[model samples]
Target: MASFKIEGGHKLNGTITPQGAKNEVLQILCAVLLTPEKVIVNNVPDIIDVNKLIFILGELGVKIEKLGSNSYSFQADELKLEYLESENFKKDGSSLRGSIMIVGPLLARFGKGYIPRPGGDKIGRRRLDTHFEGFIRLGAKFRYNKEEHFYGVEADELFGTDMLLDEASVTGTANILMASVLATGTTTIYNAACEPYIQQLCKMLNAMGANITGVGSNLLVINGVDALGGCEHRVLPDMIEIGSWIGVAVMTKSELTIKDVSWDNLGQIPNVFRKLGIQFEKRGDDIYIPEQESYEIQNYIDGSVLTVADAPWPGFTPDLLSIVLVIATQAKGTVLIHQKMFESRLFFVDKLIDMGAKVILCDPHRATVIGHNFQSALKATTMTSPDIRAGISLLIAALSAKGTSTIHNIEQIDRGYENIEARLKSIGAKIERVA
Candidate 1:
């Protein structure tokens, strides 16, 4: 296991470029299975999850060639569908929640699909009912085997139908889109997740001859085609990483510029930060954060403490709630963070409390943070990463602490952030990787 040893209380300066979005790359990679031609993808993040998905593709006989650091060409000319039942495939495939996406394309193309229980963050009980329900709506039959902890789906031919998802689950929407693209008729998906990642997937599929409308809204109308052709697509910038960097700049009182940030896609993030009294300047597509001492939490019109919460697209993302909570520790006033999506996401507040922050864990999903205003630097300590977002949040906390802090179980962080140590080092952060 690798660990990060960070020396804190140093200002991060210089311009940093955001890496490609991980969520987009995962869905796009799975979309390759729908075609037999070569798909050239650029700006793919070299993160652990992407690498795992690439390994899974290689196991299925997809030809993947690396052109450069962040460029690759993938051709699924000869896929071995039986590999889904292999023991090795079962073990590795279960390691990521993104693995569930393969089921849709495999079923749509090969008439059968098998997948073990997918694994991801243990934030809460993330059920796969929505995904399987979408598949059933598309004329697929599903069988869940409790003894083997596997899900099997089969359909001789998928007939498209209008689907109104119970919830706007991101993975569920991606799975349905992949399956509906090659169905026999049109499929209208309402209450879909129109996050930037989902939009990129839709755009890439459309470029490959799939007719999809409503790119950035809850209603998506997809006209199923016979087959998808080869297409080249560049992944969008990592907005979560951009948001994390914004938190880092405010917490450390640093002047930094993040280049190539998709300004329009950063929905409500800037205004959300503005609620914390942190301001930035937008130079074209770049965001420049000047040095600031501290930020004060804004109150409501009734002069009550403001609450920052997560919802569907256009609202604050639940993924960044951890980073926001950590940044709140340094703000001038108290703020309530309600993570409505994941039940156990707020449990990491104990780690922040160990670092001397005043936090009240209201329940499994809610927490109230009282800012320290950097009155005193957090003392360095040993910590273990619980999940991906929390791991990065702890890293940020360690970077702003007094002495040295050691963060173990970095694989969780690697699953999301691409070359995080290298990226932080570029901005004058004193961080080292150790095994």
Candidate 2:
């Protein structure tokens, strides 16, 4: 396993552009399969998970061309559908949760799709029921091979129908949207995930001739199109990475600027950081965070402790809660972090506790953080990364702590963030990758 050795108690300077959104990239890459024409994708993040999905698409016979460092053209005219049932597919598809998205396009275009139970962060139970449930509603037959732990959906024809999703699952919404785009009738999705990423997908589909309305709402209507043609789509800046950088700046007392952040799409990220008293200036689309000695958590209007919780879109994203939780260690006051989406994301706080943060784990879902207010410095210690978000959170903790610290299983971090060590080092961070 690869590890990162960080020399802590240092400040970072200069500007950094956030990588393309990893979550959005995953969904966009899978959306390319809905069309046989060449779809050019720009600003793709050079991260492990995204690269893995690219490799899987190449294996499925998508004609790929590298137009630039972060640009690619994909044409899925002659996909090798049989490969999805092979043993190699089970291994490849299971390694990435994004691979599950491939099933939507395959089932829509080829009448059949198969995937092994996909693997991802061990944060909590992320069930795939919503995906197959939506598929069945559109006339597809779903089957689960319990013996092999595999899933398959097949249909001779798809007819769009009105349905309400059990939950606002992002991937599920994207998958059903892709599938319904080529269906025979109109499809109405209630309670759809309308995150910026999903909105981008809808825009891309509309550009490719699919009639989808409700770009930024809980409801979406898709009028079936005969086929989709080639289109160029550019992913937005990674909001999670932007949040991480903001946390890093506050935690390590650094002055940093995040460039071209696509301000309108950031939702509640900036305000959430501001609620924690983290200061930043919005310069056009960029975010400039000046050096901060310490930040204080803001209480509610009625003098209740500030509670930062994660919900669906327009609420604070759950992905950055880990970073917020870690940075709160040095904040001036107390705050409650409720990671409602995932139960185990808070489990990584034990490592922070070991490094001398005052945190009370209320339960699997809630943690009350009593800030050190920077009076007591966090001592460095070795720790293993539990998941992608937690891994970045720990890296921030290590960078802010005194003394050198070792972080094992940095591969988890690489899956989500592209060349994180190099990026941080460019900003004067003392971090090294060890084999």
Which pairs of residues collide in model 1?
Answer: none
Which one is best on TM-score? 2
The regions of model 1 sitting more than 4 angstroms off are none
> Residues 44-155, candidate 2, lDDT per residue (tens digit)?
9999999999999999999999999999999999998888989999999999998999888888888988999999898999999999999999999999999999999999
TM-score of each: 0.99, 0.99
Q: What is the Cα root-mean-square deviation between model 2 and the actual structure?
A: 0.6
Best by lDDT: 2
Runs with alpha carbons beyond 4 Å of true place in candidate 2: none
Error of 1 at 23 (Å): 1.2
Candidate 2 colliding pairs, count: 0
